[model samples]
Target: MSQHLPRWVLPGAVITVLLLSWSLAVHFGHAPLMPSPWQVVVALGQLAADGRLVRFTVASLFRVSWGLLMAVVIAIPFGLWLGWSHRAERALGPALQLLRPISSLAWTPLAILWFGVGDLSAVFIIFMACFGPLVVTALNGVRKVPSVHLQAGRNFGLSTAQLLRRVVVPSVVPQLLTGLRQTLGVAWMVVVMAEMMAVNSGLGFLILDARNAGNRYDLVVAGMVLIGLVGLGLDGLLRRVERLPGLSWGFPTARPSAAPAVARLRLLRNP
Candidate 1:
């Protein structure tokens, strides 16, 4: 007769409570900088009605997707080679390590000059963000494949190419997926930052534009919520893909139960 809520229920309830608190704060705090949740909702609806929101959202998504595609094409093969061969690793590792510490923001000025203040610049920044993480993840994943697995592949008469295809690739899949999730999230973030600096037609630009138009706090708040929602949606999609049967193994095991089952088992054994 007892009701046991699903695992997600408590988190959902917590979020609802937080939103309510935020709404109340805006109403009672009488702060102009902090608009009520209803105000944000109203602004969001207006943006949707006006159609600029869709255009900017799509533009941002487009920039990230293009950059991510480019990164995948270049990073995967280069990473695989570096991971599989010591010569390639020696040649590339120091350079990659050197660049890893330099953020996408640091490259923005050069990207702006090289590509100009346009979509290309924004996409280039996203590319830089995606490339390094993807390469590092891919290379680390591949390099970590167990030698015993490779030996088993040789035992099964796999040639070098076959071994790579059938063994190495499969073994690193979980890591690849993990890296991919991180890469895409970073790609999205870079897209927003790049748009703010270089381009005039994305969500980030919209936020800047709203801020410039003076006291369009509603619009600014709306834009912030939209970005959060879009990022959440993208991550949710990735998580769903990761839960597919082939991909499920990539995730770590659920936390272990701590009940005293062993004590009960011992009593049964004695009886």
Candidate 2:
């Protein structure tokens, strides 16, 4: 019998190969500005030694958390409303469409002007970055909910609010999770940019300060690496959430051909 490779093997191998190639290229090319992997590791150690690493990381995450919370509270319900009522969509859709096309970066100056150069400005920028994708995903997901599900919800005599709560929201959670995952990436990016100009602390500020203060490209690379690692962890968390029993409909597990077919479909929204 042949054995398949472990799930993590391929990805680990690819990353190992890339790191090795990067180290070799920097060694042979003698690139002065670019830091080798080991140099970046040392830079990370330096950051940790000074305690700036943890502080910066926490600051960035705090702003991102606030922004994500704000977007979810505001955008999800608005999207649901737009999806549920054609009249609401018609009235609000044009404005939403107009703003959705605007880049989050475009809001940076205005954010500073309105919120001032602080945490609020940074959070506002991240919120703007995350808002559009979340709204769009939620709207589309609600629209795609099976009509039968809605009809059954009504048959049970659930009130409009109850129907939306027990019916529509759960129905769209999978898509919303995907939106959230994507928005997490956007939030990280925007926060970093916002921090470079708006705030005095964070990984973004660390990177900018390192470069400006001493041309410490190693610290810059280290900051980038940290961002990538954190982003990957967050994405994986959302992926795991998608596979949770409550949202299994969003991410069904594959069954082996040798096993008997068994559908353990779970509908958490069922009345």
Candidate 3:
């Protein structure tokens, strides 16, 4: 039997084919609106040579980092408290539910009014985008912690503080990490949108600037590609951090080794 192709290989092939097709289309069309891949590369190089790319990128990175960090600091504590205490959850549930559905963009006007048009307003947008998702995912992760573990902690005469620190917190870490992954994406997205409106520097501002300066389509496309690539890299880094041996200890353990035939069968047809 032929071995199955690796999953990564398929995605790589698809991307290569799509980019080739796009480049050929642009070359044939010879339109400024649709610059060829080579043109985009050249544009990127020119921008980098002028130092504009690095400066804008640093500005965007700082906004995202600060906003995401603030979100985590607030969300994790609130989520854990709600998950641990019924009273807190009951009190906060209605307000959280109300605020969670509001789009991050909707907060832009108020954010501008409160923080003015600058880094503070941009960061506020990112914070709002990251906050709701982080809180919800954290609550889910913590609430889903196995009851048996808590029971065992109680059996050992552990106080509430000890039980939380020793058992509950560690058990819920994977879920928290997963939440962070999602929040990080939202934070990145919000940063770009916020910058387009509130800030005079960053990738979002650069994209708008390129558009206003007349058909700089290559720059707009390059900025979008940069955002997507950076987001993917950040999530991959988080996944690697979570897979560290000690970090995985509280995570579910896999069953011991099975026959190769059984493993293949299970993969093909769940039992």
Which has the greatest lDDT? 2
Per-residue CA lDDT of model 2 for 60-146, tens digit only, reads: 999999999999999988898899998999998999999998988899899999999899999998899888888888888888776
TM-score, structure 1 vs. true: 0.87
TM-score of each: 0.87, 0.89, 0.87
Candidate 1's residue-wise lDDT over 1-271, tens digit each? 1158787888899989999999888878868687788888899999999997899899999998999999999998789888999898998799999998899888989998898899888888888888888888888878776665565556556688877876677667788777888898888888877888999988898888888998788898898888888998988898888788876552122342223223322333345
lDDT of 1 at 152: 55
Residue 43 of model 2: what lDDT? 94
lDDT per residue for candidate 3 within 1-271, as digits (tens), equals 1258776887899899989999888767757588777777888897799987789888998999999999899988888888898899999899999999999989999999999999999988998898888888778777876665566556556688877776677778887887788788888888888888998999999888888988798898878877787788989998898898867555342442224323332332333
Please report, in order, the local distance difference test score of every candidate based on alpha carbons: 0.80, 0.84, 0.81
The C-alpha stretches of model 1 lying farther than 4 A from their native spots are 1-3, 249-271
By summed lDDT, the worst window of 10 consecutive residues in model 2 runs over 257-266
> Global CA lDDT of candidate 3, please?
0.81
Candidate 3 clash pair list: none
Model 3 bad stretches (over 4 Å): 1-11, 28-32, 251-271
